[model samples]
Target: MRVQEIPIREIRRPLYRQNDQNKVKALMESIQEIGLQEPIDVLEVDGQYYGFSGCHRYEACTRLGHETIRCNVRRAPRAVLKMHLA
Candidate 1:
């Protein structure tokens, strides 16, 4: 895995997840104070990025108007991506 900053618009979230507003608000404050402590995990397939976790953090950053997010990138095959989608 490699850590990098990726454009939020470039990463596709395949699953619809509901994040807690309180948690997101807290995270937004923490991120604003200290920045993101941990990078979100993402899968890279065919040059495309997909996010499967970190829903709360993602929402927090998005609400904070962040254009890019830090991610732990793992390159995977289309089959793996299909498995995630499934």
Candidate 2:
């Protein structure tokens, strides 16, 4: 997988809405302390990136006001596509 830096504006929420406030904070701390343990996965469609996984990590980065995030992106799978469409 190729890692790329994508602007935060391009990131969309994942299928499941993640609103765990505590978890978000913890993740943010981890990110701050050690950087991202793994790159967030994304799917690109018509130039926009939809989050495929790593919702918590994504939110943490957003909280940190990251201009861009490291991502391993590819075309969306059928299920992943449906999630975005839903």
Candidate 3:
């Protein structure tokens, strides 16, 4: 998997579930201490990325005001990209 530092603003997250502040805080602490242990998965399309998983990790970084995050990017199929684009 290719690791890339993606801009936080360029990554889209699904809103199906609400983020837990407690978990986010814990995660943020872990991240601060150890750095991002695991890279998040992302689908790259048209220079932007969409996160399909790792929501908690994403939120933790967001709360930390991270400008970029390490991600495992993969080219998404046209159909999948279209789904996230809108």
Candidate 4:
């Protein structure tokens, strides 16, 4: 596991989620003011980055035009990723 800044466009979001607009707005404000307080968790499988959590934060950062995002990266096997997908 590691913490690093990754290009937001490189991450793959496999899940479809509806983010709370209010939360996204609040996060956008906080991120603009103090930067991202919490890094989003992502899985690195076969060198591919996959994001399954922190949907709100992701949306906020995306809307803010951030090129990269802070992430807590966990390298996992394809099987583990399949489990997440399933």
Q: How badly does each model clash, as a count of residue pairs?
A: 0, 0, 0, 0
Instruction: Residues 1-86, candidate 3: write the lDDT tens digits.
Output: 59989998988875465778899899999999999989999987777688878888999998898999999999877688777647
As for lDDT, the candidate ahead, 2 or 3, is 3
Local lDDT at 28 for model 4? 97
**What would the per-residue lDDT of candidate 1 be over residues 27-77, giving only the tens digit for each residue?**
999999999999999999999999999999999999999999999999999
Q: Give the CA lDDT, 0 to 100, for residue 19 in model 2.
A: 70
In candidate 1, stretches whose alpha carbon ends up further than 4 angstroms from where it belongs are none
Tell me how candidate 4 scores on lDDT.
0.97
Please give, for residues 6-84, the per-residue lDDT of candidate 2 as tens digits: 9988788656774789998999999999998889988886667888578788889998999999999886556767866
Candidate no. 1 TM-score: 0.98
Estimate candidate 2's alpha-carbon lDDT, on a 0 to 1 scale. Answer: 0.83
| TM-score of candidate 4 against the unseen true structure | 0.98
lDDT of 4 by residue, 1-86 (tens): 79999999999999999999999999999999999999999999999999999999999999999999999999999999999999
Model 2 bad stretches (over 4 Å)? 14-16, 76-80, 83-86
The count of backbone overlaps in candidate 1 is 0
Error of 2 at 19 (Å): 2.8
Residue 66 in candidate 1 has what lDDT?
A: 99
Better structure of 2 and 4 per lDDT:
4
